[model samples]
Target: MTERARLAVVGAGPAGLAAAIAASARGVHVTVIDSGADAGGQFYRQPADDLGARRPQALHHQWHTWERLRDGLRAHIAAGRITHLRDHHVWLVQRHLNGFTVHALLGPEQERPAEVLADAVLLATGGHEKVLPFPGWTLPGVVTAGGAQAMLKGALVLPGRIAVVAGTGPLLLPVATGLAAAGLEVAALVESADPKAFLRHGRAFAAQPAKLAEGAQYAAALLRHRVRTYARHTVVEAHGGTAHGGTADGDTAHGGEVRGGQARGGEVRGGERLEAVTVAALDADGRVRPGTERRIACDTLAVGHGMLPHTDLAETLGCRLDGLDVRVDDEQRTDVAGVWAAGETTGIGGAALSLAEGHIAGRSIAARLAGTEPDPRGWAAAARSRTRLRRFFAAVDAAYAPPARWTELITDETVVCRCEEVTGGAIREAVDELGAGDVRTVKLLTRAGMGWCQGRMCAAAVAGLAGCALAPSRRPFARPVPLGVLARAGEATGEPEDD
Candidate 1:
């Protein structure tokens, strides 16, 4: 390599930002590309500069850490060690004999092609929310829990005047509190998971006292705001009220998803929106109790089950996966050469674990790129933090498991895939009548996952209804590519060349 070794960090989130700064500080040239207009990823997302937020820190618990990362990145960029490319929607990372070529759409339209050449790549692609379908979920005002948070954080707006935050993961806590803090009338927080179930993992809880205290803080905030929280309760169905002007056909609700049309122009528009939702207590077996049904009125139904790692890029690179997460070794290196992964792409352990893993990956990559053996002792502290957080999150995952019988609660008429307008009944028919036993077969038989999203939003629901694990759908590219971009990709390209 005649020129300095160039590294491409494919996300601007906690992990990618940390890795980029660490590697660049060690003399590596880095290009940080992200789809967002700003450097901060979802966790550190800030209101637009023009918004002139009075106190953006009020929205984040880790604001100081974000300022550190942001300042470091700016410093590196000024010194010519790093470059931040905003609004670059990367669709593929192709390995060449020389190194790698990252293909991306240039802007919001995601049509014009752009490419970046790098000697190595880090896959810090992050994760997306997993929303199980329920009746009336397609109502205009129904949004994901994370989506609601992003709306508040990014756009600095409320989804509705009254909201119900319902989910089964740790993310629901901050989301509900944030909504209440933002002055939204939080009607209730309906959690399907049993709070007592967390006690079963006492060892994990004891190991992370700070995490326990954080939960207590959220509980206190909810109490102070008089936000009703129903433990072991699941949303059986969302109900919509009369529309003033028009009705929505196929409303979408996914957070930090690759798919488009998110942060929807929600109702308050002449669109039909959520008016109320039915919640029911779950039995020991995770089945809903018959007499426990109660209706809560709210204009917004913010619901989520959990989150899944983004592995499309890793899978395309022939990297190994442990379940849905991209598998990585101690240094956060993927099985594939010239590739490293960190953050939620490896697993959804939250920001702290992502930072730890990213720091380790950055230090390791720096050593390797400099042709030196990486000493694990260099990142021993980060590695310890990584291990502890991983253990705690593993227990968290188990404790926050979605209701066991959630699939049975969805009415046949409920739309499962909002992109393609496929219904639960259609998916079930593909299984029972068409004899489709797996997710791919169900997709081919009923077109359940064949929409603009290509199954990202509805894969979990489809797999559950089909009684199968989501088979690795090896997409040629991470997202849909226009025919024009594909045709032009083969022609003489004007990608920046090394000096």
Candidate 2:
């Protein structure tokens, strides 16, 4: 009997779960690793089983899809075709003469080492939110738009009684409406992108009527909640209330009463929690228009520019990158042999695109490992859906890009890097005074990207402030590793050679 190839899948998101199910159905022995407590990843994030919620599906949009993926995974696991390692944080993947070794930290403590050996590896690591900072962004009660949603979905908790959702992406729509539906008083949905941009991509937008309808549904929900929307606008600064003393109306020394949405007082204060956020209109060039500032009172601020692909593992394996995302062929195979990538790592398309890509990749991987060429006809429907979704999201990406001159909103004193507390003044000094040209030089000149996050939150902002193009950082390890794990890995299999 021919032995089935062992495949290791990183991530338990829609892409990873779908890929595992598809490959296992085709006789591939699969092991799925994820950092979360359960399957479903971030998109279909569910409440804890102990929550005993009556209607968990109310928090999700495409509930049926999640059920299918979840059930498929369970069936495969029961049949001994798949093994799921939950709460496994993969730090690195090293290619060896025999196969590949996936090194991961297990459990909440993340101190124990676990390794998976496989003849082939599939990366579905997903993406992270891009946080461009303004004044008071690091203040309490200021969470990313996704973070707010995750709290709602995973913990069944609202960020605050009153909230303001601001950013430039499709994510804002759901975050705002979801909060409102959950009984939070949503003050505003401030969007930085001009709505007129969609008109330019009308043809592309019209091609996907389903996407259009989905957006319309969100709009209807926002209308039902009476959520005020401000197009071509963005948050300039968030004002928090102090414990020392403030007016009954939440006014502080730094900020006074918001008259017509404009703060009439002095400088903004960073207190224990967020109280309000100042928003400003953007001009055609993406710069904040003069005298258009408004302050909306709110207890929480949920903000995010967009998402950035996680390419650390793929980059370490010498896979090609198309701009910021991993470059994959039609079968979702990377240029590197015995490797495949799909989902947000390929681009920032949503869940539908990810599922299609994952299914195709699984079919391709299963066939190739069995010494047969994958028939394109087998995955034709998925490929077609992938193409359509890619085109549709391309338009969405173009329409929702951050304002061209968003950097203008950052004052010299505003903290850009929250990890190291690096201010905008320090970044400017690195460029103008220190003569640093690129992000690397700026990081070296000022300890901007050297903090705990390793620049994941601040890299784009730093690059923008420095007037440089953003590039993928080739990190050897995806997550921080204990020195002991490194030493043990070296002892077990010798140190990995440089590519």
Candidate 3:
């Protein structure tokens, strides 16, 4: 048992960082916990401390916001008002009488269970890429767009010499451009969204012309790099066997690791690594439009559909969720007492919106805890910003909304969950023959989401393939916990509770 903090914020991303700063400034004893060794989350990932990465800002969009937050955090830490714990991967959070108890795996070397008790908790767990399976997605040299970006930012290494970035979101532009800027021979950018969606929501786009200009600048960069961008396109397969094969012929390691590949375009020769990938146009149903398939020689495949909020801790506390996302009021308070959420954990509004939301939530919580009436004025402007930005996000969502007929694209032999080797036919049988309408039921029958990954690798694909509502998975631990830690959680002599 440790001294209880006035407030605890999970995630070191923009939201949690800003919230901690605001709360501490208001005289609230705050603790910010995160998995990163530093304050920035995935958005502002920095290179390894020893790497001497001088131009870290070059890899991020809102560099100033990070600098401001980081400085504020340092000031607070020096003053002893805030306790910032980096590399503290929170595994479990439970609501107590007047507050909550948080369990975390602290530091890279320390394995002992570290617990933090708090009067209030704010969840800013952030989000991860949604993996929608394709025919050749299970191949070496393939990675999520964000994952590839992380490699460039954190390790200062490119996944390959020639990379093809394909996805349906605005993130693809930056990833492709960043790889190209790093001297990688970017083959092309394949987007699955119709460009007309911008026109459909012209007002929203007009409201954020800066975003449009940013996109335009990225386009100009792509042009300068001689990178071809194909809108309304997708990578059908990653073939290692032949230049024209429709299937990927290598090992698939999801979640950011590129197993193997070599450049194979122009001066880049392909021999023992990723040689080529098949790019194609998807019909309205998300299936490969037969004749649109074209072989594009490349060394790496970077792809992602979108992102989903990480809401397990909030869900475990029985906080009310709006659809799959945590339902937060204008002030970012969840239904559970002493709990709040902001940033991508609440919803996907990118880094800028996350900072604003975090500041609002922090201010609101600080005001209420100090026995003062919550004015929520600062948050009002932030809310408006969130609304405007979310509209653009909604437009993007609608544009890339995975086609309804994509479930039919999966062949009976195609593996739905690579971890378990569960096939499309098994999932279909679970749904059609076994009356499994929901994801849990399908998992129970087909064991698709029951593999080592615990469904992180295949949840989005399963949900989309089943045409069911995508829900945030609720588990006792945020990540894999040691058995000794579990035993330390409680007595080891008792039998496990029945499901």
Candidate 4:
């Protein structure tokens, strides 16, 4: 905090770690900041010490790669070239005449606003799960696919005795397979991608039969575990039970939900416990193909549509965006001077691509600092392994790109905004009756995006439901700031605020 660091990397994930090492090796004084206490990002979540997990590597893939990164970080940290700060939740980044200042909230109380000054910055903030809303989705037993995996890997706990993994993307296979491996009775693996899409990209898939074979291994595990697989299907509704806290069961193929009732105004009607679910096949529009509805008896449902980049800091710095991702040239340099981005924030490549991009960006930044030409020989070699993988990912994204007809999935009674308890009907009324065409206008009228999350939860769904463009909003304060802190910083006193 006293002397400004020459290079600052946000996020301790693979990319950030690699970048810090790459820069430090070149003699650039570096500092690494992360929200989690560990160097591994979501990909490498070690169990708590109390758990006594003897072999944490058993729950991870590419374990050797992580070990190398961790060892390198220790060397750099000890050498005095790198300063690693963990549990720092950076909320904003501001440009200064000298370089830039990164602002973050340091602890659970969030009262402490700390600042880090850096001559060059690298943003490797990862991605967050994309949740597509449905009835009973807010129930206690329902969680995201990644969240479920995190629980099994990090806490060594299964979400429920029986689990249903439903969503798009390749993430479902590993999650379901891992749950089954962990002794959970996986009810089903529901995927919305048409199998034919894989065939369409058969050449690319053939080029990397290892990936195909890896997927086959997962399929074999699911089959051995008796976990049913549903293709081109989705969970349209979630029903609890008849009475509050009662058990849930379906009367017919798509009839009943136990502990909770039908999803009404986005709120579950009945109880706290989740007992069953109703799933249906969808046509091209993501609507329930009538007569295809079926019920599955499971205590927990894990569903996630896709992912999006965490681009708040990048956007705040006036970096241009390409489509839904941050735009970066070959070297991963953003338009902003001394600023760079990588990982899912730049695009929706998985951890492997993110690691590669991070290395390239790190080397580029380091070389520039040393007054040498930036060379991408190392990063490009790893990226070459993606000859077939990248194509498959692209196909996967296109096939599952939020069904264009999802607008018809929600009824007026269905709740779209969980925090505000706002229903699909209310959002529709805001557009039709109240003439709320924009996300801000709808937020003002229904308070949909004004909940504890400050719009991260329901903004996209609301925008999609209201037929508005999915755009980001720029705010004065990135996170909740105490009035006292604002006053101490010598900033104007805003009205009363709460987090």
Model 4, position 409: C-alpha lDDT score: 68
Query: What lDDT does the true structure give each of the candidates?
Result: 0.85, 0.86, 0.77, 0.76
Per-residue lDDT for 340-452 in model 2, tens only? 99899999999999999999999999998898999989999999999999999999999997878888778899999888888999999999998987888988988998888
Error of 4 at 283 (Å): 2.5
Worst 10-residue stretch by lDDT in candidate 2? 250-259
Stretches of candidate 3 exceeding 4 Å from the true structure: 1-3, 108-111, 241-273, 284-286, 490-499
- Model 1 C-alpha lDDT per residue in residues 381-460, reported as the tens digit of each score: 99999999999999999999889988998778989988888899999999999899998999898888898888989999
- Predicted structure 4: clash tally: 14
Off by over 4 Å in 2: 1-5, 243-271, 490-498
Clashing pairs in 1: none
Model 3 CA lDDT for position 416: 76
Per-prediction TM-score = 0.93, 0.93, 0.89, 0.88
Query: What's the lDDT for residue 265 in model 4?
Result: 23
Q: Candidate 4 lDDT (Cα, whole model)?
A: 0.76
lDDT of 3 at 259: 27
lDDT of 4 by residue, 1-499 (tens): 3336888899888878888888898888998988886788888776666766666776677889999999999999999999988777787666766777777777777777677788889999988888878778888778899998887676666666678999788788888887777666789888877777677767766776777787888889888989999888878777776444422321111110111223212333455756678877878656668999898877778888888778888887888888668888888899988899877788776777777777777888888877788766756775574334456567657655545566676778877788899998899999999999888999999998887776777878888887888787655555777776555441222221211
Cand. 3 Cα-lDDT: 0.77
